[model samples]
Target: AGGISEALITTAAGLSVAIPSLMFYRFFRRRVDELVLNMEEESLKLVEVIHGEREPDRTSEAA
Candidate 1:
């Protein structure tokens, strides 16, 4: 039979691991969302350039 100390230690260990794992998961999730938004914005700019709706940026041209 497990004693109170075992139960408490298990609970504490689980929480310690879980909290950081959850935080990292959320951080990466937000980063993925930001990357997707950036991709969409860049793609739209590409479409505009191809269609002659807008001029390509001078900075990009210089590069």
Candidate 2:
């Protein structure tokens, strides 16, 4: 019985921090991945426009 309750309390406290820490880590990791993918797509589009492989969008010019 020695230190049984204390050990459990410590374990629970560790999980309280660890669970949310892991969740936030995954959340931000996914967010960063999405952003990087978007940036890559946008950069490809820009490269196409710069190299005359694709026509430039003219909506902003008309606006």
Candidate 3:
């Protein structure tokens, strides 16, 4: 009886820690994905500029 009670207590404790840790891990993973996408976009723009594939807008330059 005592062994079963101890097992149950440990199981509950482990889940309490695991659930929140998993949630935080997922949240940060999504944030990292967004950051990576933004970096890729900026890098592509830089590459375009370097190759002269994209022209700078005259209106933006005037501003």
On TM-score, the candidate that comes out on top is 3
The better-scoring model by lDDT among 1 and 3 is: 1
- Candidate 2, residue 17: Cα displacement in angstroms equals 0.5
In terms of lDDT, the best-performing candidate is 1
Ten-residue region with minimum lDDT total, candidate 3: 54-63
The digit string of per-residue lDDT tens for model 3 on 1-63 reads 999999999999999999999999999999999999999987897788789998654563554
- Per-residue lDDT over 1-63 for candidate 1, one digit per residue giving the tens place of the 0 to 100 score: 579889999999999999999999999999999999999999999999899999987786654
True-structure lDDT of candidate 2: 0.94
In candidate 3, position 43 carries an lDDT of: 85
Listed per candidate, the RMSD to the true structure in angstroms reads 1.9, 2.1, 3.1
Ranked candidates, highest TM-score first = 3, 2, 1
Pairs in clash, predicted candidate 3: none
lDDT of 3 at 28: 100
Estimate the overall C-alpha local distance difference test score of candidate 3.
0.90
Report lDDT per candidate: 0.94, 0.94, 0.90
Off by over 4 Å in 1: 61-63
Any residue pairs clashing in model 1, and if so which?
none
